[model samples]
Target: MIGILGFVAVFAGGRWLGWAARWVWLLAWGWLLVLLLAHAPYMPPELGAFVGGEFRGWFVLGVLAALALAYRTGLRRLQGRVAPVVAEARPGAFSAVELDRYARHILLREIGGPGQKRLKAAKVLVVGAGGLGSPALLYLAASGVGVIGVIDGDAVEGSNLQRQIIHTDARIGMPKVFSADVAMKALNPFIEVRPYHRQLEEGFAAELVAEYDLVLDGTDNFDTRYLVNRVCAAAGKPLISAAITQWEGQISLYDPTHGGPCFECVFPVRPAPGMVPTCAEAGVAAPLPGVIGAMMAMEAVKHLTGAGQGLRGRLMIHDALYAETRVIGVKRRAGCAACGGG
Candidate 1:
């Protein structure tokens, strides 16, 4: 009994002192080994008596402990493999868990309970899952936006891991939309995530944009950007668009329906091919997207909850190389192709 108690005490003390589990196990095993040696034929009888346990009994205890540890490890692995199901909150009300989770936002003067409730009721669509979209989507989900739709046709690549922080190396081959969906759900399961693993087509662009309250464009190419802008303009949905290149990025809220310049109004003519290089050709800084993407999410939150001023009618340019930021006012163009000075 004394030997068993001593072994337990040593193991518990080591663990309580924040020792590594392997070290604690080693200490316990060393204690048992000492007891076994004390019981050896060559040891003094008084030592064996003092150790207070038969060798076989101590060995059985060690086997039981190993089995228990193995069982716990396997159980934990199984639990990790299982997907957790979070309960859905009733419409127009927050559950206890949600209330606690958003207590900080609720306590804020701007985004109080009513603002948070608006966030919970809002729906947003993200046009890409790359650098800018990664942080934008993550923050939107973390902010408890009710429903988020992400659309992308590309697969996660090793090259994207640097700027696209939402994707992991293990998900390199996964579709960007699905990867973003997984990350968003993992961050906050209370929100609904709709992943479209296909390019946004002109056929469904208008229909899709109409489904969400707002749109965020983070695509790299010009064709898709123009298509998204056109569809968003036709649907009268506000678009928060951002673009990042080597050491620089820009974001704006384009909503001609709300007295703001649409994307085409600000830049009517598409840059000549090869004149403006993509990130693949230009090589952007790693943290630049996070900065701009987080700002995009912040603007979206502000737009949805009416917490503060939004980026409507203004373009924010961030020059990471020089650590400078500038906001320039934009206006609706009279003969804009997408949104004609409405």
Candidate 2:
């Protein structure tokens, strides 16, 4: 009740002060931080202990409860309030069972308990349930990444069973996202899988990508890839893009952590009409996206866990026909356009 009254007083004062308080959002966040710190364990020993031994206990509990309620209420009342930032979902302390189950990953110096925690807290949205999307979804879910969202509007056909490994004969007619969700759940029930069985467009893509920590472009078309890039750029979400054509494939990370080039920076815009042939028209080799898709998944895991150097600012190209690979360095444009000056 005290916390509530204090917040009410501040809000009223802010309103009376008019435009001096530019944003109530910041005011709410500021008050929330103050409340958390006041309820922290830094009080004197007598005030920190439970019972009368700690003047801090009841006060802390009451203030925390009040702050939490106020924070939620203010968010619902504010404009442009986003989902609460969930601490970046990095790894931290672990239970014995998690240690045993993830012994290999935990044993690695790069991805100790903290890194695994981050991975477990990550929410990734895979944009396609087809070729590249299939492998990325499976690997990310199996890796114990906490939440995975699969978005696709297509239905499974008999032909998709070859590369889209998540779908089965029994799920041949099911929506690809729903089918993949079931398979992923079966693989690791511990992970939360959100399946979206609808086509993504401009506004909806913005909203969907905004909710996730990162996005993976498993899509195969120029139009969808452009759409995904625009959405991720606007929403400030990292994006991993992979494409397969004939016997060749490429993977790139449009991550902003390095302040490097985004997918838009590299591709700029879609090629002129007929400038590039579609995989459907040109006939992609069956194993092409599988090999590249798995790599894309690995990059995502590495990124989520901060395990090692990611593909940020670098594009990887592979040609299975000739068994050759190439790496191209990418740089964020100073004034080229798109995300640069935005």
How well does candidate 1 score on lDDT at residue 230? 93
Give the per-residue lDDT digits (tens) of candidate 1, residues 257-316. 989999999989999999889999989999999999999999999999998899999999
What would the per-residue lDDT of candidate 2 be over residues 1-342, giving only the tens digit for each residue? 454555687778778877455475467556655554555677544322322323354456658867987897798878455665332223456556556767888788998877778888889999999988888888998787888998899999998876778889999899999999889878866678899989888767887887899899978778888888877776678899998888999999996545867787887767888777877678788888889989988999898888788898899999999999999998776654557722
Candidate 2 clashing pairs, residues 3+ apart or interchain: 89-118, 90-117, 90-118, 91-114, 91-117, 91-118
- C-alpha RMSD values across all candidates: 6.6, 21.1
TM-score, per-candidate, Cα-based: 0.77, 0.70
| Predicted candidate 1, C-alpha RMSD | 6.6
Worst 10 residues of 1 by lDDT: 84-93
